[model samples]
Target: MTADLDHPRRGGLWHHPEFRRLWIGESISQFGSTISQLALPLVAILIVQASTFEVGLLVMFEMAAFLLVGLPAGAWVDRMRFRSVLILNDVLRALALASVPLAQWLGVLGMEQLYVVALLVGVCTVFFDVAYQSFLPQLVEREQLVEANAKLQASESVMQISGPSVGGLLIQVLTAPYAVLLDAFSFLWSASWVAAIRTRPAKPERRPDRNLRREIGEGLRFVVGNPLLRPIALCTGAANLFGSMATAVFYVLLARELSLSPGLIGLLGSTSAIGGLAGSFVARRFAERVGQGPAIWISSLAMAPFGFVAPFVQRDWTLALLAFAQGAMWLCVVVYNITQVSFRQGLCPPALLGRMNATMRFLVWGTMPVGGFLGGLLGSMIGVRQTLLVVAVGGALSFLPVFLSPLRRMRELPSYAATV
Candidate 1:
């Protein structure tokens, strides 16, 4: 039985039946999500005729769940069945997304409906993600995490690479509003596969002393009180904040100012996917050579200069600069995320996995909505190009937290990271 699992001494995750199920389910959903990431906004822009602020607000609504339920949701997920939570969210997201095209077909679709759908999706995502992270430890041995995460990220990379271009063309052919139906159906497919996963996650250890506030506080302290985890949170949080600022208006810039078609805009999205694919491909080897800790900070600074290249993009040959910058950023981030996520996952106690991941998500992804709003505000004030420059400048320094930490001096991180 052990020999058939994802043991390195065994055949790795490919031989792990349950992990393969999760991967196939997640990969298909990711492809759909990737396409919808482009299609949804295009629906807002082209069909709904949303303004810049409205578009940014759309982004905010999509991510607002992290701020609202990110903490307590983790605690709640800890108590629930992982399979139930996963399947429920997948179904809910499918229903919510399906509503988009239905409303359009009925000639009743509006920004209000879109915003509500985005919020519902965000809420489900918050729960699903927390449960998913915690569920992984039960699915495989501790040693298999990096390999598992890399494979998962690799599939995600492929989806991202192809999804945008395909989505862009689909948007043009089917019209953006109807294009969302693909993602709607994909969620159903994801749910079916998740229901088929045979690995039953044991019911969580029950504690009579469980309190939401106290549990949340415990998770917070575990992250914030630790030197290594603290810096990663800060670095990731900062990068996301500033990155969101530029991305808030990125579509607007491409569609409105640059006058690019949906197909072209989507092709540009491929730059990051290309980078992400490279990062996933080389992540394990790169960490081995450079040291896991070094990989984190080195990848961070290596892409710093790329941020400055984005705002300088032109309609001509310089388009490649934006692509390069986007790709470089994704490349670095994928490597950084794969390493750091494995580190943190391996670091926490099983009971704390949900909370630790939730706390981390709050710290990192919570900034996205705020940044989106800021990007919109700044775009109105400083113009889109200048706002991107600000994002670039601030993003260049996001690696400082990790760089200044003790991890900078270490070679590899042990699962049992003892540094305070």
Candidate 2:
């Protein structure tokens, strides 16, 4: 490290070696995981020819572990070395995913196996996320957070565009279970890359709060009672719940009701990543100018409109254009999310970050089951398009909580030294 204070790091992304490795590994893994995300459901529905209810159950099962294991995992992560936790998580997930392909080769792949794999992978994912977040602050200076987040958002946008196309093609050629093998390899790659990055290990046995309950409660209070985190939790939770509802029925609407080909839908889906990329490209500049809070609010407001437009997608390339628009809205969401994470990482005490992240996700992601269930119920009764419309309206409208709260003016993370 150079001693010149004036010459600070240039090229936000290029400055941090660990962040660069992490970003590269993450980007590759995201592409692979996104493919699995699409392939999993397709396998459930198309290959097994499962009913809509079964598909819904599969999705719910995948998300259920987050609810079951998140907080406890958070407590555990706080007591361990985050780098080792992340590496172990990747390895576990890789083995679990690798099994699906092996089972498929043996002609014994079943719904039970799929459910079990989904649940296990979800559990590993929860641990990885909590631990990884706790480890992020040590990788870069606090001021560089927005830049790092922007880079992450950019990678996610690219994955959004390409991952589905690759997944669809792989599924077409190798079958869904085999497609997951690509994800397994990606996770292994990620673990290898993470192991290569050198970082100071977090000292084990440094428990901050006594008793799991108190630690959990401290984390929860930070998120739920904070001036910034509270509204973010509410808005994002509503978005996830309703967005899941709308998306749960999306393939049925596009493929069955609208008579879209899988290739075309995948193509349309790819266009959303373009919007996401563009949104990320602009978000850092926008956030820097107007503040993180306002950027998030803007993203929140746009979410519903883009979602509402889905049902109105006309035939021909118009559908592609509408998909592109939705992608742009998704980009806004990515920017907002990255900004929020950057702020949270910078503001929270390092010792409490794991619990805070876990607690926040528990509340936000816990809505996934409800959304999946509602999507199925509503699609069955009121029809898919109508159901999606309702979710779009309801989810977007839920942003009112953040808009009315103290969040609107919170432009940046208050200095870490500032006490709540």
Candidate 3:
């Protein structure tokens, strides 16, 4: 490696070979995941002829592992190799997803299989996601965290932009069941690239005092005790809880109520990714100008109006309104994510990174299961449009926790090095 690669600063990760492999692998992986994101729900909804409530449960099962094993997995992975965890999970998820295509081919596919596969994939995803975040700091320099995250987010956003259209097309051609095969293959492709990565993060040191419960507590305390993380968690948790409700039922509205074709549904969903891509394109500059703290709250506030606009979408020129609303809301979402996640990664001590990330994930993502349940139940009780309106209003304002807290006062992403 050249000196530039050895001691990169100021977004010099672009010169790093191993990072490129990781980036490319993850980008493809994300595209595959996006295909499943559409395919899975479609399979549940159309293939099985599931109700709105079943679709909600399917979504819930997909994320339920975060609640079941989230905390413990963090403590577990802290002592394991990041590469091994990532690779193992990728293969596991691939196998789980591959089952869908196989079952569909065999004419034995049903809701039970979908639920089991969702649950298994979710368990693997919890591990992969936690490890993926914790592993990145090991790949690049501390200062490059923002740029690295930006690049990754940009690619992810790009996948979001293009993946859905492709997914919808594939679903149209192959049916949703077979379309999921791409996601399964994508996981295998990712694992192969990860296996080739030359830069291995050092194995975490194991301590004799490492009790699982104590380690878990230590991680939780780090998040809860930290002034910055606490509010971020609360705010993110609320956002996911409310936003996921709409996500659970949004496609149902598009497919069943609005009677959109798969191609149109995918095209509409791609609008959100367009916003995310735009946000990723501009996140660094925006944060630099506005300061990360202000950026966070302002982005949150921007989401409110966008959130209000989504439920009002109709089949006519109002379609453009959905695009604008979804685009604007996701733009804010991406900006907020890039800002806060970069801040969180840079703020933590290396020893606590896994636990800290795990705790944060648990807090933010654990509510999703509840949200999925609520989306289904409420969609059933109050009707789909009414449910979307309710969740949109709550999700729109979910940013209040961070907006009301110290984040609003800090001019930039505050350095917590001294505090940690």
Mind giving the per-residue lDDT tens digits that candidate 3 earns over 298-324? Answer: 888888887776577778998988888
Q: Which pairs of residues collide in model 3? A: none
Report the C-alpha lDDT of model 1 over 318-341, residue by residue, as the tens digit.
Answer: 888789878988999999999999
Per-candidate Cα RMSD to the true structure, in Å, reads 1.9, 2.5, 1.6
What local lDDT does model 1 show for residue 208? 88
Task: Sort by lDDT, best first.
Answer: 3, 1, 2
Which of the predicted structures, 2 or 3, would earn the higher lDDT when compared with the native?
A: 3
Q: Tell me the whole-model lDDT of each prediction, alpha carbons only.
A: 0.88, 0.79, 0.88
> Number of the top candidate by TM-score?
3
Show model 2 residue runs off by greater than 4 Å.
1-9, 206-209, 418-420
CA lDDT of 128 in candidate 3? Answer: 92
